[model samples]
Target: MNFDASLWLIFILIGLATTLPRASFIVLGSRVALPLVLQRALRYAPAAALAAIVAPDVLVAGGQVEILNPKLAAAGVAVATASLWRNPWLPFIAGMGALHAVRYLSGS
Candidate 1:
């Protein structure tokens, strides 16, 4: 497939935008150390990012809380699996399996 010139430019711009901040940290971190408070706070970034990514998908659908969302059910299964098995892969497998099982059973 042939990509248009504008599409190529957009792709390049997006790559640069994403790469620049990460590269800047690596380049500048050697010259300066971030404050201790900021360093501690940054530790939460992954959990915060994960919650930001997941909360909406689990709790909202069609711009509202979907009580019957299969995702919610699957998330519960995943959480339970994670708590019980304490394995990273098991939660993901359980979540996807629960999601598919719910969808198949409900025919939706």
Candidate 2:
């Protein structure tokens, strides 16, 4: 109920909440199995999580939507480069090249 006691309690709860989900597989071992559908869907979790993180940065600028943004075009170029070739570095290089090219041309 006191300030220090409540703070410590909240910290402990937060730590437990964070640790439980990550540690569940190890603690439960093979005894518990996720469903087949869930297992299949989990394969895209990393890509989904990545998109969730990268999307806002790519699509937004100046805290607002700008259709002509260099980053937006760079993202499109990167996606296209990724689709056209299997090399991982091509997309990065293409995206960065497009970004710099647009920035230089637009003088922005």
lDDT of all the models against the reference?
Answer: 0.90, 0.92
lDDT per residue (tens digit) for residues 30-100 in model 1: 78777999889989988999999998999897899898889999999998998899677999888999999
Candidate 1: the clashing residue pairs are none
Off by over 4 Å in 2: 1-29
lDDT of 2 by residue, 86-105 (tens): 99899999999999999999
Top candidate by lDDT = 2
- Would you estimate the TM-scores of all the predictions? 0.67, 0.67
lDDT of 2: 0.92
- Model 1 segments beyond 4 Å from truth? 1-31, 86-88
